[model samples]
Target: MLRADGIHRVAVEDPGSLGARQHLRHCGLDTPPVPVDTDGVRVDELRATGAPAVLLTPAHQFPTGVVLGGERRRELMRWARAGGLIIEDDYDAEHRYDRPPVPALRSMLPEHVCYAGSVSKLLAPALRVGWMLAPPAYRDALVAAKRFTDLGNAALPQLVLAHLMESGELERHLRQVRRRHRRRRDAMIRAIRAHLPGAVAHGAAAGLHLTVTFDGDFADAGLARAALAQGVKTQPLSWHSQRPGRPGLVLGYAASTPTDIAEGIALIGEALRRLGP
Candidate 1:
């Protein structure tokens, strides 16, 4: 889309989607960081960048977990209609545990939104199976790009995924995983409350990960290092942020059992104490 629109610059949420940032840089495009709040990416801030296009993870924002508010969605549509473009990465929209499902922005404004999804999160990442829905104007270009990238993804995995989708097995599997993930999410929240006082968890209502922010003077990168030294892995929120803010960590609980989640968080708490406020 950036190539087709003659746009060399793009805006992405600060402490936002890492995949989007990586891809933008890989293409040699300038990705100015925009701020995200309780309502998702700040469209007003995006406008300030004057970038012709913005990449967004609206349903459940990466790291932060904020959904795009209704008003902001309309504002984005207006922005797109006025010649700006939106690259919507519909990442992890299927794993909602609380509240009704939020509709994808593409549903309302297909012409301006380039939507992408994959079974990597659903089933496994090794499959490398996914699909894209692009507007007519950019469809051919995207396809050509995909073809040149790796001559397209493997076919057997795609066929297997198709069979799973056709047999309703995928939906059934999702239902099972949702239950497990919800339990894990609940476990992480409990662990946070018990072990890490003063830490606030964000985007708990959906997605495979939870972002916890702390109001303190501790350096998140140092804290992450300490946690890693204790054999507890974590991604410092600072690693994802282009701008400065409070210290935090982005933790994923999908693969961890509740007991492991509690142990890992407790180790993080210990690390925090060792590092001081």
Candidate 2:
């Protein structure tokens, strides 16, 4: 869509959606990192960049997990109104365990937001099924792009998913997974408190992953490497950052049992301690 719209420079959240960054770069678009705070992507910073388009994970921001505050949402809409484009990646908007559900930014302003989502998190990435809602201006072009890109996804799986959706089987599966994911999230929080005091956890209120930031100086990459050596895998927060920032780790709890979650966090704590005071 960006290429079709002739938008070559795009603004993305710093420490934001890595997948979006990868996609944009692959398409040869220049992506400038705009800072994201408690309220979400800093529109002021985005405006300063003078980029015509931006990719956002507003509902549950990637890595950070902070929802875009209401006022910021309004600000973003205003930006879109001023001819700026919004690429809303509605990733993992389904698995909320705490607080009220946040509405998708695309819901508020469909004309300016290109919303994309997949069943990758819900069902399985192997299915390779997803959908996008593009504005009228980009719809035809996007369809052409999809057609040229491997003639679109397999129709058999898409038809099967449609059947699951129509029969309400998908919702039933979601309810079951939500319960399990919430338990794993809680276990990770408890383990963080028990084994890694002083480490602050973010995005715990929702989403499948939690990001924990720590004070003082420590190489988060080194910590991740140490944890991997002990058979626990983690993504260093720096991997997502375009600029220098605090040391942290982004850990996903959805696929593991509570016992495994606890053990993984404990291993991370051990790795952190070994990294020194």
lDDT of each: 0.90, 0.90
Shift in Å, residue 132, candidate 1 = 0.8
Off by over 4 Å in 1: none
What lDDT is reached at residue 254 by model 2? Answer: 89
Weakest 10 consecutive residues of candidate 2 by summed lDDT: 15-24
TM-scores, all candidates, are 0.97, 0.97
Query: All candidates: CA RMSD in angstroms?
Result: 1.1, 1.1
For candidate 1, the lDDT comes to 0.90
* Model 2 score (lDDT): 0.90
Off by over 4 Å in 2: none
